[model samples]
Structures are given as C-alpha cells and as structure tokens.
Target: MRKSLISATAIMLFAAVIQSCNRKAETPMVHPDFETSYWIDIDLAEHPVRGYWRQVESLDPEEVSDSAGIANASRLLAEQYGANKLYVVYHRQFELDDARRIFIHWKTEGERNGLEIVPTVVLECYSEPSAMNFSDSTICDFASWCVENVNADEFGIYDVYIRQDEGSPQDTQMGILREAIGDKLVRIGLQPGEDLNSYCRSGVEDTWTAECQGLDNELWANPDSVDGTDLYGRKLLASWVAERADSAQSRRIVWNMIPVAWDYDKPVDDRGYVCPGDDALINDPPILGRIAKCHECIVEGYTDGMLTEKFGGYSCDLHILQANSAGHPDSISFYRQLRNGEPYTGYFASAMNQVSDLYKEIATFKQAKSKK
Candidate 1:
C-alpha cells in the first residue's frame, strides 16, 4: 500500500465492496459513488492478491490471436471467482475485435468478477508497437473511453521506452494518464529490477512521482543461485522485501507485485516453462512472509500450460495437481485434480484464499507496528 493509502482509501474500499454486491445482477454495474465511473476496489493494501485472480490473463503479442477466446476466458474468470481483480497488461495494439472484446465484453465480465482491471498500456514499450500514441489524446481517449463506456475499475500505465524533453518517458506518460483518467487510480508499473534507492540518490532534480511501484516478479525474482549481495533467491527474497519495505516507507511507493514467471534458471534467451512445485516459490510461511511485506502483491500466474485450452498458456495449477497425483519429494500437492474437479481457475481460487489469509495476518501486524 502507498504510505497514505490507509487513511485515503478506507472509504473507497467500503464503497467498492458495496458495488461488488451488484455482481449478483446480469447487467454490468456502474459506480454511482464518485462521478459515474465504475466502482473499483481500492483496498489494494487490504487485499493481498494471493492466488487466483492476480494477472488471471494478459493481452500480449505472443498470446493466441483470439479475441473471442480471450473474452470468453475472462467471462469465466468472473463467473468462477465472483469478485476479484483481473490484472491484464496490454502490450500490443487492439488487434482484430480486441476493442469490443476488451471494452464491451471484457468490461461486462469485469463487473461480474468484481474487477479492478488495471489497464497498464505499454504502447511503444513492446516490440509489437501498440501505436497508442496516435496523438496527445490517444492514451487519454482510451482511458476515458474505458471509464465512461466500459466503466473500467482502474487504469494503469507502463511508461513508454522513448524519453521526453522535460521528464523521463515513464514520468511523462504517468502525468498524461492521470490527467486523462481523473480520480480513477493511475498506478505506475515499474520496470523489472528498478531500484527506489537509485531514484532517491540521483542528483537529477525531478518533481513527479507515482504513489505505487509495480514490480513484475514473475520467475525472475526467485533464483537458484545468489548474485553477489543481491538478495534475489527463494531463501533471500524475504531480505529483499525487507529492504524494499524500508525504501517504500521513506518514499511512500506502494509495492504492487505483478508476476509472470517464465525463467529462474537459464538466461533470458534460454528460459523455458520449467518451474514446478516449490522450485519457483516455497508455498510456506516464509514465502508468505515475504509477500506480506509488499504493499500489494499478486500470485504467480505460471499456470498457462494447464489453462492453455481455456487461457493461452503457464501451468502452476497443473504443476500442483501433478505434484499431488504423481507427488514431489520436497513439496505437498495441494489439489487432487485440476481445480479439485473444477478447473485450473478453481485451484487458484482455493490456493489464493488460504495464502491470502496468512498474508493479511502478517500485513496487518506489520502495518500496525510500522505506525507505532
């Protein structure tokens, strides 16, 4: 959570829960609270994105080029999970019927799922070229349309690769996004390996800053070997979290975790979907402890392999099911079948529910102590 999030967001969080109740209805729910934008859950600090709904799926260039398929999967996400945030990162242009699928169809499902669809548009950041910068108002228009049309919960930005004259690319984009989206959340998705201390230490004068800093933890976070003093491993991530928490307090940057793990062993060029069981993360108290330190954290979505039929790809769920049915030496198979007889989605929901409780316990304790 951002340092000031507690006092500022308590009311919004309450309103959102109320709004979520509308999911019982068939039509999409609009937030009548502030303006007419959809009521989005602001209890990021309170909600530890434990298992299921955390980047449920993403609209990337590599994903299967099927808008209808993606939309259907999104609908299932809402129908199955009820109300939870679906963190989707859009890196390419709205290809095919992507616009309707995302804004109209996806938004409808978003309401059903009680979504906080943080549309982090990384237009030029990716090689696919989202071409989002049609003009000064392109990104703004996109965001405005989401709120007014789709009634999207939140809008996030991953700064462009190119630099601006006044500020860095990210800083410039963040400003534009905030102005366009109005009071809706304007989260800044930070690049992987970004260090808060570097920004603090840089003598360069800067006036802009984002309240939250989202890190794409994925598989990069947990490494098999330690690299010098860098605390980046299954055993050392807790230390990294502790250090990051200290910086978060000073800078008031909300540590939002965005995971898409595809590597932890080989270098980037040689990476594969080899993660399984507890190899990527220890499903235990210590790992949960690390997660609690962050302001907001999402569960890893390496389950695409198992969900590829419904979703594009990763396999955290299959990995767990396999470990249980086939079994693993060092890990416990939590589920007996795919989603315990349901699907991969069900498995994630169950895992997140259990993990979320523990994370909240630690987060609540740590947050209270910090104020003292």
Candidate 2:
C-alpha cells in the first residue's frame, strides 16, 4: 500500500509538469505594443518573398483585398505572441546615420525587436536611364555609400536579396543584388523559403568604413552618388528626432506645419510662401502660396516640418520642432498635442517658445549650459 501511494504521487507530479510545459510551449511569443504599419525597405528584386508575406493570403477571412489585410494578419500573430507595432525601415540601401536614425526611431515608437540580419530575396526597380547601375552584385551609384556606411554593430547582419516580381529584365543580374544585413529575421509563415545557406556564402567582409566617422556632416547627406538632390541628407532631422525619443528627460511631440497654399482655392493665411512657387503649385497646388499672402511662415514647402502629413494625420511615428533664439523649443506643447493624438497648427516662432521650455525640462544637466 505504501509503495502504491508513492507511485501515484510521482505520477501526478509528472503529469503536472508536462501540462505546465505544454501550456508554455503553446503560448505565443512575440508581443505587439508598437504601431501596426511597416515601411518596407526591399530592393526591386525581392518580389517572391515580398509577395509571399504581403500578398497571397487574405489576412482577414471576411475582407477580400484590403491593403491593411496583411498588416492585420501580422498584427493578429503578434498579439498571440506578445509583440507590439510593426514599423519597418525599408531602405533598398541607406547610410550609417540613417540606420542610426532608424534605430532611434525604433527606440521611440516600436517594440524593440532587437536587430534582425537575414538572407532575403528582393526585386529591383529603377528608371530607364539607370540601366547601367544594375548588376549581379549591387547597384552602382549606391555601392560606394553602402561600402562606406553599412555597419554590423549599428545595422546588424542581413542576407541581402534581389527581387524579380515584374518580368525579368534583359540584364538578368540587374534583377538581383544580394548581401546580408543582420540576424534576427525568422521565416515567418508569409515568407518565401527556409534555406539560410541560399544567401552569400562568405558573408559581409566588413560593415563600416574607416573613412566614415563624423556625425556632423555625413549624418544627413544622402549619398550624393545616387541622386543629385539635396533632400537626402538627414542630419538635423535625425538629431532632433533622436533627442526627442532617446533622451529620458525629454518629452516627444507631433508638429504639423502645412503651407496655406496647399489649399490654393481656399484662402491663404498669414503664415508663409510657397517654395519654388510654380513647381510646387503645379505638383501640389493647394499647398503653395506667396510670401505676400503669409509673412510669418518658416520653411516654405512640406520639407519645413518634422512629420510628414498624410491623408489624415501625420505619417511619421513621432514629431518634433526646432529651437529658438531664446533657447526654447516646442517639446512640451507638441507633447501635449500628441498626448491624445491632437493636431498642432501654430506659428514656428511661437511654437519654438514651447519647444524651448520643453527642451530645458528634458535636456540633461550637461546640455543645460548649451541652452543659455
């Protein structure tokens, strides 16, 4: 009788342990606290993988072909696992500072998924004039920038890919550009295949360049090699953005500054003028105006503000404004506006007053002197 009782107790304990293990195993892992939208940075060549994950299935059983379907499906999976927002930094190619800015953005807005470096396939898209830029290895104009700025410590390891979604081009290699970025990528259900070895065999010989160091100049200059435009350099914007989120003492805010001219037929305000007036007027008519119409305006075009205005609210996850001569910045005022996702439409100088106070409150003791 004694032996039987002991045996029964042991059996019960074993069953309990098994049940606990099963429950844990069944519990989904990733959490979803961050935003649900993702900005994909795929090259034109990786269509197979993109299609597999983004297309193919209807994320919602009821909805047919809504754009948010895949995002919703991914969100559901994340909820089951315990994850947050699904913001993606989609750069066919980006520089070091840009990657850092992206990291800073991740820190501010989304659940940190650590850093993922994985093998991927992508499709390449380019204009007719740039046919010479494509090759089996990588694009030409962007290569030097990649060689200079790509960093293992900052961006992490990734298996690069060339996508071929549209019909293959005459130059087959033009459709592919393969390299690895970082490591945390998993073969989620919507992905293409599972063979990790399919990527580059030897892997990245190096990530960062010894020549690339300073945060001041190179930080914002979008590689001049790719496009001749001044719009690519991301320095000041990245700095302000990074400080807003990463600084523990600081508050984050959203500032929406659209030109009165954007609503052309509508009455113009006393804010600012339309930039390159004719060009912007033709492209985005409603957003352009003359300096005579609005005297107090700051920067003229959409480039004037931190966050990009979309159809409804701002597109960027976070927002910020510049400082003033009085050593003020609009951190708090903007924070208040965004506390409940409110819209901010104020004068640049006045807004700077709010930003100045917020900056002082959030700025570290070390930076306090800078304000003075």
Candidate 3:
C-alpha cells in the first residue's frame, strides 16, 4: 500500500508539471507588423509562435548628455509626464529571409456574366526572407526577434498592390506574384482604368501588387508619409496604437506618431511615404485629447535622425501626454510640473505611497482569507 501511494503521488506531480508548462505557453504574446505598422495580440494556444522582434530604446535618459541640445528633453518629458513610469514599445523591421519563414498564399475566384474574376489574395504568415548575400545587412530578421523578446500578442505585415496602368485586375502582375508566393492568399481585385502608377516606381509592379491584396488583415493599408488621409495608411496606425492598451502600464497609452518629414531618397511608395510634417499629427487637436480618452498615449514619431533635435527627439514631438481625472489627481499636478520644466519629485513620492498602500491592502486581504 505504501508503494502504491508513492506511485500515485509521483503521477500527480508529473501531471502538475505538464499543466504548469501548458499555462506558461498559453500566456498571451504581442506582435506588431512593421509593414502595416499595427499591434496585435496572439494567444499562443490559438496560433503558432513562429518568431518576434525587439523595440529600440527611443528615449534613454542616459543618452541625453549635459551637452546635448535641449539639455533636459528626457528629464523634462519625464518631469511633466511621470518619466519612471512610462512604457516603451520597441519593434524592428522584417528581414527578407524571415519572409521565407511564413509562406501561406490564398486565392479565390468568382464568375461574373460567364467570366471568372478574382477579387482578393492574402499572404498571412510569411517567414523572414533569406539574405541575398552574406554581406546583405537588413533589419527584417530582427522583427521576429523583437516580437519574441517584447512578448507581443499581435503584429502587422505589409503587402503591396499594383493595378494595371490601363488594363483590369486580370492583366496586373499581382496574380503572378501570388502564385509565386504560394496557394493560400486573399486577393484584392482592382477596377479597370485605375491609376496604377502611384502604386510603385519603374520595374516593381510584382512587389507592390502582392502587398496590396492583403488589406483585410492590415490596420493601415497603403501607409504614405505625404498623404495622411490615405484610407489605409496613417489613420490605421492611430487606431492600432490605441487598441494595444493591455501591453502598456495601467492607465498609460502608447502613441507611435511618425515624424512629419522625409528621411531618405527612396521613392515614397517604397517606405510607406513617411513624411515628417505637423499637418499629419493625428486629427485630434489640443494634443492631449487621445490621452484624455485613454489612460496613456505613447506616440512613436517617424523622423529619421538623432532624436535630440528640437523636432526630431521624442520628448518634443512624440512623448506621452498627461490626462486629468478625479481618480488621478496627482497626475494632473504632475503635468503642470512637466509643462514648467520643473522636477517631478512629488509625482514619484505619490507613486511610492500608492505602492505602499497596495501592499497593505493585499496583506489584509490574505490574512482575511487565511481565517476563512
């Protein structure tokens, strides 16, 4: 009987270990697609965890040396916005080889008046593309790494579309590109006589046409730097950032605002038309509107240069905005300090007090539970 009990106990322990592993793997992971520039949460149980990317430290206080221009942009933003308690969402680009990792192509066709027509094509899960050469240095591979390290639940991917210069969707190279990628895809049929020139530069119709079909899965479809009103572009970015609240701290919003200018010589379509200008700073005026609606608005600016320049750095254009609420009275006062460029000593002290009070409450609750 003693031996039997020992065997049963061991079985129980083994079962418990398996259960624990399953739980750990089930934890929700976050992902952000750079092509679409949106955030998504993926339940590991629901989807396979293929790869991930890491976020860059856009705002490191240590990087702000005394000699750096605007000496205290980091300190200033922190003082005004509660620096120690901010959330930094980091993500990297997709490497070409990683592109090979996920190759799911989908296709569908419909018959209209005795003619078959295809409407949509989708490339859902693609692995990073392999580097063309060993010397080829790209950021795409880092995206999967970032997703894994950041523990992201959702991510965005980009596909381009090319309508024929004058012919209908059937004549476009998109169909060929879809076939090249694989079979399972979501295709977007284009209207005849559509202006296809805007989709890409010379000798690149196949590339853009493939990306354009995967609009359903995207938050921002054709992201352009110059045209903020591009239906699937910047607006989608604003919405995606707002949706991923659980990843950030409680009562904090993370905004990924692109800068208002161009940073490279490449064609606009190649880089989602990232223009750095004030006109595109989201339609919300007073700047604090997004934060007021949500607990946090962490904006990711889209300028390519040292973040310290008055307009380039995050603190000046892409920093957090404090919101006023009856429950968060201290937050309102802290905003005032940041606006004045003063220190946030009181804000930090208030945070500590809240933490201490929470510990006491937990201790009391545990004691009460023990009595029961």
Q: Pick the candidate with the highest TM-score.
A: 1
Off by over 4 Å in 3: 32-332, 336-372
Per-residue accuracy of model 1 over 144-259 as CA lDDT, tens digit each: 77677655455644431333234655456546666666655433433233443222211111101110111223333443332243333322333433343334342322232211
Rank order (by lDDT, best first): 1, 2, 3
Measured on C-alpha atoms, candidate 2 has an lDDT of: 0.26
Go through the candidates in order and give the clash count of each: 13, 72, 100
C-alpha lDDT (0 to 100) for residue 85 of candidate 1: 44
Worst 10 residues of 2 by lDDT: 205-214
Better of 1 and 3 by TM-score: 1
| Candidate 1 colliding pairs, count | 13
After superposition of all CA atoms, the RMSD between model 1 and the true structure is 17.1
lDDT, candidate 3, at 29: 22
Counting only residues 3 or more apart in sequence or on different chains, how many pairs clash (N, Cα, C under 3 Å) in candidate 2? 72
Best model per lDDT: 1
Query: Cα deviation in Å at residue 333, candidate 3?
Result: 2.1
TM-score for model 1? 0.42
